[model samples]
Target: MLPWDAPLAGRLDRHPFTSELLRGNPLGDPHERPLWVYVPPGYDDSAERYPVIYVIQGYTGQVTMWANRTAFRPSFLETADAVFAAGAPACVVVYVDAWTAYGGSQFVDSPGTGRYHSYLCDEIVPWVDAHYRTIPERESRAISGKSSGGFGAMITPMLRPDLFGALATHAGDALYELCYLPEFGKAARALRTYDHDVFRWWDDFRSRPAFTKPGDESLLVAFGVAACFSARADGTPELPFDPVSGVVEPQVWERWLAWDPVRMAPGHAATLRDLRAVWIDAGTRDEWFLDLGATAFRDEVLQSGLPPDRLHFELFDAGHAAVDYRYPLALKWLAERLAR
Candidate 1:
């Protein structure tokens, strides 16, 4: 497990709830993909179907990253009264661990990662709706994420309006500018040397051209996901932290392109018309270098001719701290939309 991953299993207690995982699900390969499920207290034998939200995360972040990464339960609960607090028409929140590290999984289909888009749309969602007492109707299903996840929520609803009814995003991770950079190119070439677990391969990504330093993710915060979503030749995952290998793999770059929501959104303009609701918000003070870019994406998306009522965009005075202002607003926004 990555260093950050080690802390998660223990911190599970922090939540005022019980969480479970799926092990050995060869479906979301590379890392054994698991679904972290949280059923509110009132979820006991109620025989009622609840709404569901898929919470995705940025690069390098796992499904449980938000749970372990932030102190959001209290605020998120109150803001999303339906899911968190007293269970007012309570719902289910699903966090699917997407691509991490090397740099990808805007949560779409990619040549490198097999058919993740199909997996979520075809497998994951179906599994959730089948097993859980979820409100299986598209109107009852919602999708949201932070940074890269935000991009996924934005792009997914636009592409597959039939599956998800509502969308919410915060401090989104938009990859409009990063894919063409030199480092991404280099990593694409050296994909063969990737170290699946310990990044026992390639040199640190800091040396790549025009690439943001691993820690210097000023323009964006999708690196954690970029690494996971990115794969080396032969279906191996890329390790942005690995320094001995010294470069990017080729298919890795393809995977990056595959997940880039910016490149694909323009073509889906008409699809946006079907969306019931859409929301985009980010911290103006976000350290990620792409706050301006995030705003630009929101504007461009709105300009795509989707009704003004369907698009919701906001800029707040917060930085990139998770579980604080952003989380509350995101959940509240989703609740409001799903209420419709």
Candidate 2:
């Protein structure tokens, strides 16, 4: 594919959104975020309202990355437009931005990361409903994402059943013990150069190529997630493990465990049962072992009494990166079940 913008049969409206909740965040990340809304073909010709699917990004992803063209494939926008053009179920798609100075906010509310969850549920959802020809009901809305975005998708519907009744997660982060703990060792080793201070590592990280160092990815992810999950009241990110010794700090680590989707499912059983549709899939060879997380999450949802008919779970044959092709698949699956 050419490294240029491609045409879409549907209309993709771009808007700049200023979030009151994110204003003056401790990180000083941008308050003005780019928001993209894709209206399917013939959206304006009729007075009919459409269901909405809110699309979130993975860690370190920005809104404009949705338009990025791959070597021989079309971007997701084109694929999704083809879904509508082929007379499949039609819905409005909203792409959200939740980036931070440290890479991403994990789309959660934290003293260090800002009130990103509130910004999405309270501000962005309402703003979209008011500005578009949307159905304006929880049953008509769904959320979908991959990785960190996948984690947001899994939890958002459970947290706000009044706003979203359906969701689709592609290799979402879960089963924290398996997914996160192994990285602590790598991060701890990387911290040696900075005297076991993550902030010092952060300073050095910002001054050069992001992942040039051996443990840059491990350290960056650990730091970013710590900011999202275990920030102190003063907005300082506190590592869940000792940066030098790699010892687990029980209190801080528990905070991270509490956000794990597999662990949270039991408490949110009623909400999951009330959901209209839930789609989940992960690559069998996911480097992070999120496929196991997917299985655990699906089992918990089942044990929580979510009806089998309302669910679609799968294990695909692939790895984590370059799975953008899966987005449109989940979008169509969710669209079929959403209120028409």
Instruction: State every prediction's TM-score relative to the real structure.
Output: 0.67, 0.98
Which runs in model 2 stand beyond 4 Å of their true positions?
Answer: 1-4
Clashes of 2: 0
Q: Pick out the ten consecutive residues of candidate 2 with the lowest summed lDDT.
A: 1-10
Q: What TM-score does structure 1 among the candidates reach?
A: 0.67
Residue-pair clashes per prediction, in order, are 42, 0
Q: Write the per-residue lDDT of candidate 2 for residues 104-205, one digit (tens) a residue.
A: 888899998899999999999999999999999999999999999999999999889999999999999999999999999999998999999998888898
Q: What residue pairs are clashing in model 2?
A: none
Q: CA lDDT, every prediction?
A: 0.57, 0.93
Per-residue alpha-carbon lDDT of model 1 for 17-37, expressed as tens digits? Answer: 111221222234454466766
